[model samples]
Target: MIEVRAPEPGDLETIGREAREEWVRDRFRTGVDFSPLMDKPNTHVALIDGQPVAAGGFIDRGNGNAIAWSVLGRVDERHFVGLVRAFRKYMKATPYRWIEAHCIATFHQSHRWVKCLGFVPVNGERCFTPDGREFRKYVFRNHNGS
Candidate 1:
């Protein structure tokens, strides 16, 4: 069973140990650290049978907008759908009216997953990270929320 809860200090390290090489390299090159996120409000970890599979949350950009970020560990294919459902549930529970996320333009699976979580691609808003990888912007907007 996958249980989503507040992140523990070691969760990031645990995930890093089994994360994909490309992801680890990108993080290192971009200086994308998850340590500070552990201190952020609403951050969470998804644990399957007491083992963390993922951790992520929102970083407030103010004015009802926030940046969404997450890190993944070695995940079982069977648990993919469940994890997506958990992510959607957590996203909806947040107070932010606009949530923004970015994914590598070449990673098709990532694009699909974010869309499944209710994010839509931002037209013509491509960005490049420090590593020179092209990324596409995605946003989740709650028009009915304040």
Candidate 2:
């Protein structure tokens, strides 16, 4: 069973340990120390059988726009779907006007996901990280509470 809950201290290491995908490793900012993100606000963790499997957070970018990011340990539909739903819930509650998500264009699954969940493409701009890998960005608007 998969459970999604608030992030705990030092859980990032567990997620890192479970992650072995090449793209997942490349998804992180190059040369940036990630230890400080363990306590980052608005972050969450997905656990299966009491072990952390994925972790991520949202960063507020002023002017009612924010960005969301996540790293996974394993690919499981139930867990991924839960995370997406939680993201939608957060968008609905927060005052942020929009939230942006970026992923490598080669990552077809993620590209499809952000699209399925209503993240619109923004001018088809491609971005590059410090490591020089190209990426695509998607934006999701915060919906009015209904």
Best by lDDT: 1
Window of ten residues with lowest summed lDDT in model 2 = 23-32
Regions of candidate 2 where Cα sits further than 4 Å from its true position: 23-32
Clashing residue pairs in all predictions, respectively, total 0, 0
What TM-score does each of the candidates earn? 0.87, 0.77
lDDT of each: 0.84, 0.71
Candidate 1, 8: how far from true, in Å? 0.9
The clash tally of candidate 1 reads: 0
lDDT of 1 at 25: 40
lDDT of 2 by residue, 33-144 (tens): 6756656566778787788887766787888887877777765765667656755665567666788989887777778767766688777587987888788999988776
Name every residue pair that clashes in candidate 2: none
Tell me the tens digit of each residue's lDDT in model 1 across 40-74.
Answer: 98799999899998888999988989889887778
